[model samples]
Target: MTPLSPDILDAVAHGAHHDPHSVLGVHESSDGWVIRARRPLAAEVVAVLDDGTAVPLTHLRGGIWEATVESFPGRYTVRATYDGTEHVTDDGYRHSPSIGELDLHLIAEGRHEELWRVLGAHVREIDGSQGVAFTVWAPNARAVRIKGDFNGWDGSGSAMRSMGGSGVWELFVPGIGVGTRYKFEILTRGGQWIEKADPMARAAEVPPATASVVTDTAYEWSDDAWIEERSRTAPVDRPMSIYELHLGSWKQGLSYRDAADQIIDYVGAQGFTHVEFLPLAEHPFGGSWGYQVSGYYAPTSRFGSPDDLRYLIDRLHQAGIGVIMDWVPGHFPKDAFALARFDGEALYEHPDPRRGEHKDWGTLIFDYGRNEVRNFLVANALYWFEEFHVDGLRVDAVASMLYLDYSRNDGEWAPNQFGGRENLEAIRFLQEVNATSYKRYPGIAMIAEESTSFPGVTAPTSAAGLGFGFKWNMGWMNDSLQYIGRDPMYRSHHEGELSFSFVYAFSENFVLPISHDEVVHGKGSLFGRMPGDHWQKLANMRAFLAYMWGHPGKQLLFMGQEFGQMSEWSESRDLDWWMLDQPAHRQLHGFVAELNRVYKDHAPLWSRDHDGAAFSRLGAPAWNPNVLAFARRDHHGNTVAVICNFSGVPLGDFPLDLPESGTWTEVLNSDAEAFGGSGQGNLGAVTTDARGSATLTLPPLGVLWLHHRADA
Candidate 1:
């Protein structure tokens, strides 16, 4: 055997080498060419050249075998006899590094916008060999190896080489292709070995199994026209009514493709312009509803493959419906198989316990101050838009990321450098992500679920603001639901709760969201919150829906609420879809469809949502009658007048001032009998007096929408 350094040989034997390829593949020695192979538990090792010449190699110390050949072979395979059986495969170490220097430079600088293209397990064809290339970032690890089903879950022979100073490890194994499962076995700096799923995996095994899958996409998108039209129109200018749903609980066993076909038709028929999904990122516990993400890049395998998700989005676009996904960049669960304790250090999370840990959620907060960590989240936001063709991202839990003392006691947290509770690093990270997302994908919406009085949340980043496209009107949701849950008699005394939202309605672009959060966690279904008997509860719901659509903002309704599902939402079970069989539930379902229809057909309700002059109160709140009247005006001088009556008694000869009218037609009446109401309203039209005022009978616990006819 040719002489080699003893330390180098020992490192190879112990799988502790920083650069294993230097000592394992074919090398030029003073005495001709030497071929080296590592095959543990093998009885014999042989080298097979491209010309079909097989040469036996002598076993050296510690699973190392070598032979001095007369000449160099352009290509070769390694053959090993294990348990009296011979297995031949292409030499994994013979290939060059799969990642380039430019990629390493960009990664080191934390400026790789397409980071997913270089980091995960990807199938590639390099140098006429078909195989899968695996790459990961583990700068604090002593060594790393690839372990998977191809190697019988053993990694002794698949040790990877570290790309110097880049914190990246890579290997291209030439026998495994797509669908192969794999994970990284890292020897931490403390000499402890841990297995971790790829942080950038495009697909993952269904939970209870934590292996990353090798994947590639060949989907031909059919949404060019949709993309072109979307880029030209601002989301605020278009009428947006979103139907938000959890895919797993919508129909328990449906795959992505199955849900797409059903959801496309339902959303289209109901007249919703868009559909929002709970986070589809891969996660371990189904109970989290995908909020605690394990794979930032992978579509959850609970539904289907990555390409299957692509097909779902493409089909929705073809049907003229936009797609928005919930994105959780706030924190992640402390699962041992995920990013927790990765590299035996707090690599992905903040080092300080006060800043890193979320005691309330039992999760770890991200270290937004870290450049590489910020890049991971920023590129992740772009990945959805660039790869999956999603039109928007509803950022989850903004308040938690913004405040340092959130859910913490006085002594449990630390203040920022400015002696404030604000998280400056997290603020900067959000601004960068929002600005980058909008700059790269024109007309894409970035919505924030912030519940605080934070200033300039929806303002432009150039003006030193957060740059979100819209902010959820959480105060509006809480106040409105609180007011409606009261008895009709007591509601009259608390009318401020219903009308106070308008005082600052146009302060920021807003979405009035009745999200899944309001329906879960022991909070009963929306129907159960209406404080009344069955009939009055349905009527109250109808009135609330009408008011929500007629208000000055976009609207998002959670699933199962349209049909008055009687039970609280549960991720463990499907929605109460069978409730539609009842007469009242069926009628409420039809009522929601009609409400969406009237909302879209009128420009006044949505076109000037952000202009304060677009909305005006008809008069002071009617304390005794429990009625509130308002009007919305569009830029083109069109008007929509809305009257909501919360009392159980119908009001006769109720005078309401009109914007301008000779005759006003009842465009939509929640009491029209078709919606299972008492069917009392202004017959079909009401004539105004010389003062532009009309006297009409408002139904009990109902709403009415009136529009002036041009000819009148």
Candidate 2:
């Protein structure tokens, strides 16, 4: 037998070797071929070749065994006897590198758009043998070993080989398949060991248990028609009434599959075109609502497996409702087992605390300047669209990513090269991600939850803009909700608070969101926000919703608000669904359903939403009367007039100017008895005079949708 170096054998035995495959597998020496194996706590070790030759290996020291063979065994299995119990398994070190040169090149260059496919623990087949190939990037680590359930949580014999200059470590372990729980045991340069979950894991253990899962999905989708249609249609041109909800609290104790039918049926019945879920990425704290993501690629195992989420999305798409996931690329939590201080140094997060930390959120900001980090986030966006078949991504906390001094004091931030607060690297990353997402998926919407006046948020990246398909209209939400929360007796002086949204409504593609943000943190529910007794509260809510739908933008309402939920939102429990048992609540729910039906049936409400010519103010705001009116027109010249009365008393013979002199049908009346209203309205229909004027009876704290009859 050829003599082996004692230091080399010790390195392999201790799992500190950077290239374990070179010394552990079969190698040719000057005299003959030699085979080495490392099986800790084994009484005997043997190499059995495909030619039915079993050669006993001599134990040297520290579980290292060696033997000389006359010929090189092309394919072989290792037999190890522990306490006289012989176990046979394919040799992991015999196989070639699972990742290719091109992949390594792209990964090193930070241009690997499909980084998830290459970097995580993946169930793969090599040489007709089923196993998993694991890869991770940790340039500063002295060594990395694969430790999992298969190895008794030990990595002594599973040291991974480093790919030079790429900072990537890889290992292909045989005899392991899907559903295996694993984590990387990395040896830092300081001689300390740290365990981390894979950043690109497609599936992970349910939070409170941080381990990357070796997973392979075989989910068969039935949404080909939905996908094909989405590719051709633009979200901006379509009607998008998003129902935003937190899946965990939408109904407590329900898995993804269990909630699929319920969510699909409820959203479809409510006439919402899409359902926007709170961040579904794996997070340790359920209370974080998934904003602080640890596993960027893995669908939170809290909802079942990754495939379970795919099934839920598939069922929704098959039912004709699109899914939008809230994505958080702004920051990650500082969990020890996560990406914080990865590789015994600052890796995924920025090294500088001023730019790297979010003091308000107590999270670590991503190092957007790094190529690999940028690639990691950009690819995560694509993974959701490509893997989950999601229709859109509502990027969370975009304002935090755009400005370096966001939520920070002047002395706590470092400016860009041009001495500006703008984070140039993050801006570049956003533009790249948006442009790439659109180029790859034509109809997918990339919406930003940006609360600032960052110019051109929805403009094209080619035109030097951020290139988001839509931005949440935070200004509108704050102003409108503030206006509606006041007593009706004092609302006349606050006309601008409600009407101000129209001034910049068309500035960017906006979604007038009464989102979860408005109904949380002691801010009460939408029903609670209304300023009046029970009866008038419902009236104000109906009027507010009517005005929102009639406004020149898309709409997004948080869960529970549709039925006038009385309490603030809580992620710890299910929504107040029991409120539906009440008559007034049921009526309000019915009114919202009918309102969505009317909104969808009328093209004038959505078709030309962004065109200035399609919208016109109906006279000026009637401050004393506490009334607002607007006219919306479609390409076919069909007009729908929306009139809202915020006063406590009814107005008889209210003079309103029509876009045309003809019969106008009262399509929707919030004051109708069917919706718990006072049953006061303009008797179904009215005729306008030659001057395009009509005398109408407006309900107290109510709204009306008047559609012009084509035949008249």
Candidate 3:
């Protein structure tokens, strides 16, 4: 039997060998072929060949059993018999490593853009046998094994062989197919054993259950036409009115497929160009709103399978609505069975608590300095685009990723090599991801939700900028909301809040967002923010929305805002959809629709959005904080003037500079009663004298949209 080496048997018994294949599999010696197997608690072990030739093995110490065969038949099985139980399994050690050496080299260099394809449990056909090819990067692990339902959740049968010097462990288990629930059982360098969910798992057991599921992301996509058109079109020059939503509560009793139809119809009906979904990755806590991700590559099973999400994205594209997903690469949940202390060591996160932990969020920050970690996140970004065919990605909490001192006081954070508060590693990772994505996905948008004044947020990477297509204008949202919340009696005192945005409006490609962040956490709904009676509140909201549309940036509003839902957004339940039955709610909804329609129809409104010369302020900033006027002009000099009266009382003879002298039509009136307004408004059209100026009576708590009759 080639004299079963005692040293080799001891290494196998201890599970301390780097390559178990050398000792456990069938190997040729000078004399003949010898087979070795380990079945710890077995009474008898037999080598069973393909033709059912059972050769009994001589027992050695510590479960080592050996048998000598005349020749190697290549494929054979090991049958172990214990007390009244017989276990038949293929020789896992005989299989070749599923990962190639080149992949290992690229992984170590951190240049594997398609990293997920290599580092996760994949259902692959290896050696003509259909099964799963599993791989994981747990550098600090002493040993790694695959355990799943197929093996009674046991790891003793097979231990993954670590690729030399690469810290990656791989195994190809024959006969395990798709939908198999599995996890990596890793023995850490510290001698502690743990089971962790695969970080690159393409699908997971929908929360409540943390096992990673083997899935084939092989769904047919119908978004080819949309994708082709998207690649050829430029998004910055187009009108983008986004309706941000949380899929869980956007509607009631709806799966991903149902919500796809419902949401697309609603967004399209509202004349919005895009839908921005809150974080949709797999998360354990529903309240985190998918922000505290567990499976970075798996779409939250709360909706449906990965294919179900693709179906949703497909439907949205088919219905002419672009899908922008909110991606949270800033932090991840510290679930014990997940990434936390994976391999019983700080594998995925930084070693230091201050650098790794986000106290405010109770989550762990990513160790961006690690190349494999960087590869993980970058590949995840591309996975969403390539697999699900999402149109854009709104990177969440970018401000958190940018600053090392984010949400931390003195002595609580670490500085970069340059002694700056910037996270240099994260910055490089971000820049690389942005550059790579833009280079690969031509017209795909990469927007940032960065609230800080870090500079060049939306600049091209070639210009030493962050290379984002757009940034959420948090400053504008905060300023406008605070200004609108005050009584009209003291509004002019805060007039600068409204005008200050113009000074930096063109500084970056901005999406003026009144997102869910503005409405939750005791901040109150946008409708509930305005002062005074219901009528005044409605008027103020309409006027504010018109101003947002008139302003020089794209717009994004959360789901309930369009209908003026008074209740705050909740992740557990649906929005107060029944509120739409109220006349006020329906009118507000219709008003937003009209605003979107008008925004898209008027080239002047969107064509010159980022151009300073195309937008000019009328009157003075503080002349009447309760009243302000502005004119926006298109390339052809077609102009639309927006004037607002913020006070409760009406004003007469409000003179404003006009681009031309002619009959001016009042296209929209906030107090027009159709939007639950006071019905006070300027008549259909008014005459402007030859001085390029117009004088008109304004409605109480109203905003006006006027254009020359010739252009209207």
Candidate 4:
């Protein structure tokens, strides 16, 4: 018999091998997994397994490549040739990794099952407090105590007592209301001290970060009339404008209530239908943008009390605005008061080094295979929608969750079935959350921020989909931003930027986002992302905005983008309001308002069953070399034509294909004097001819919206 490698033995020992016949899912028939690239096909490639085993993955079929190797049970990494083989590509990606296990029995309700179940079955509550009552499944703890501020940094009071063979512990306390913090001090059979957050606490102190808090959540929603107006899901046909925001930094340093008041007022005035907040869950570090979650049950206390959060949602609902909170279930921070040393081991995480660590984010990933873990996540997702009345959840970092080999360097990460990156357990958990959320609250939407080319994530669950309602269109965002930032002379080569996304536009309901991710870590601001002189920069921005609003997807803009804030955003201070004094910056702001105004008034902007002609029948480049023209049609066959020029040179006699012979009125223009533009064109309107085309004068780097009127 072949000598078993230590990794192979450990994998089986720790319950990592369930099939009994496979390791890393590399059976004889399928020795390698394949990856297909998008454009700019890579030339060279290298691959390595978790045990430092290297294998060369080769490009073979239709931008797809594959490789295979002998027995290896952990994750792997790959580097590909890009930019003429001179630039090594770092797309922040990783392949697959597997895990191994050990056979040590500490405690069990019966026979300590998977890590998730073991940690999810114990219940503890505060003493004499109208607060949280939560359960975990640690059947082996000799003593489990509730720690943190409510008990004055002690666990002796409000302690959990074992309840016989049920393998459960129970406690009930009063007076520990919202903001009363706590954690679990668990003593295992091995006599080790493990500190953990109360798994079901409603709100925890997030910044000046400390212990989890108990919150008796009760909100007197005075928006019953408003609730009725938005109780049902909005039609997919209506304009879907989302105001993306970060709860901590969006409005100077405001509480959840403060942010909500500001956003609700803004949304109502600006004609947007939704407000999407960045992650609000309890996290050890603020810099992770809430991606490094710890307390799944609690809202971040840095904002306000749990009830205050609920009040924020209520106020938003009152203004007929939808609310969506960012939810991170992919990984947890390794803080002592969090999930790190729970039960004196990596109880919530995988025992195998490959599965336990997330290399890119440097966080601890969850053991999703454990039923109890899946249950915990699913329950948490459902709880957010049900308890908080949140209209939706924007799941963060889903690509990382779905893949086992994300961001692992050579010989680092793990693999799964088919020697691939798919984490079946994570996929199963997402499906569970989708089903539960839709079943419980049909109106609540679920959005995924999955950058990987994962198909069907927003499709119907009955059709084997992940069941999210929408997903962030990362491809569109990346490609369009790059194209728009280029000089007009170089744009023709990249003019397909807007059209290229059409390949996957219909695959899911996509949100075209200029999110916080693009504005940080030296990426500069949105306006900064553009090239050219000041006037040219503003013009390019206006053109980009016009095209984005006219694109065939939902819309989302980060908070400060509306007013052309010049500085990069930071949670430490307010956005740069002083920049609005500049002419070019002010012009960009006014252009956004006009875009929003036009988007709100026109049915053609978002009407479903989009007229195919909108993306077809383009005139040649010479008519207006820098301009892109398209038309959107409503159900009644009414058409609205949009044209954008990204150039710095003015062009007259720009010929545009006309749908009718009547005169055309210029309903909107980014260069209008009121918006700080030079006012170089006719102020109110213009006319068009009937011979399938018309001529008009277009100002430098301007956009125009023309409507058909029968009379000249």
Q: What is the TM-score of each candidate against the true structure?
A: 0.97, 0.98, 0.95, 0.77
lDDT per residue for candidate 2 within 1-712, as digits (tens), equals 4476889889899999999988888899876788888887899899998988999999987898888887777888899999989999888888889999999999878899999889988888898788999999999999999899999999887899999889999999988889899999999999999999988888899879999999998999999999999999788889999999899999999999999999988999999999999999999999899999999999999989998999999999999999999999999999999999988999999999999999998999999999899999999999999999999999999999999999998699999999999999999999999999999998999999999999999999999999999999999998999999999999888888988878888889998899998888999999998988999999999999999998989999999999999999999999999999999999999999999999999988998877888888785323243888889988788889998898889998888878889899899999999999999998899788898888889999999999984446
In terms of lDDT, the poorest run of 10 residues in model 2 is: 616-625
Clashes of each: 0, 0, 1, 35
- lDDT (Cα, tens digit) per residue for candidate 3, span 1-712: 3465777677676665656777877788876788888788799898888898998998887887888888885888888998978888877677778999999999998899888889898888866677889999988888888888987898766678889787898888888888999988888777777888989898999779999999997778888888888998668777888999888888866889888768877889999999999998899998888889999999988888888898899999989899999999899888999998887878789888878999998989888999888888888898888888888999999999999999999999988888999998888888988999988898898999999999898888889898898899999999999999999888868888888998899899899999988889988899999898887788888989988888888899998999888878887888999989998889999999999988888777787777888888887313566777888888787888888888778887777667778877788787787888877766877677787666778888788888764453
Worst 10 residues of 4 by lDDT: 91-100
Note the Cα lDDT for every prediction shown.
Answer: 0.91, 0.91, 0.85, 0.66
Query: Which numbered prediction scores highest in TM-score against the true structure?
Result: 2
lDDT by residue (tens digit), candidate 1, 366-442: 99998778888999999999999999999999999999999999999999999999999999999999999999999
Q: What are the root-mean-square deviations of the candidates from the true structure over C-alphas?
A: 1.9, 1.5, 2.4, 20.8
Give the 10-residue window scoring lowest on summed lDDT in candidate 3: 619-628
Better of 1 and 3 by lDDT: 1
* Residue pair clashes in candidate 3: 492-625
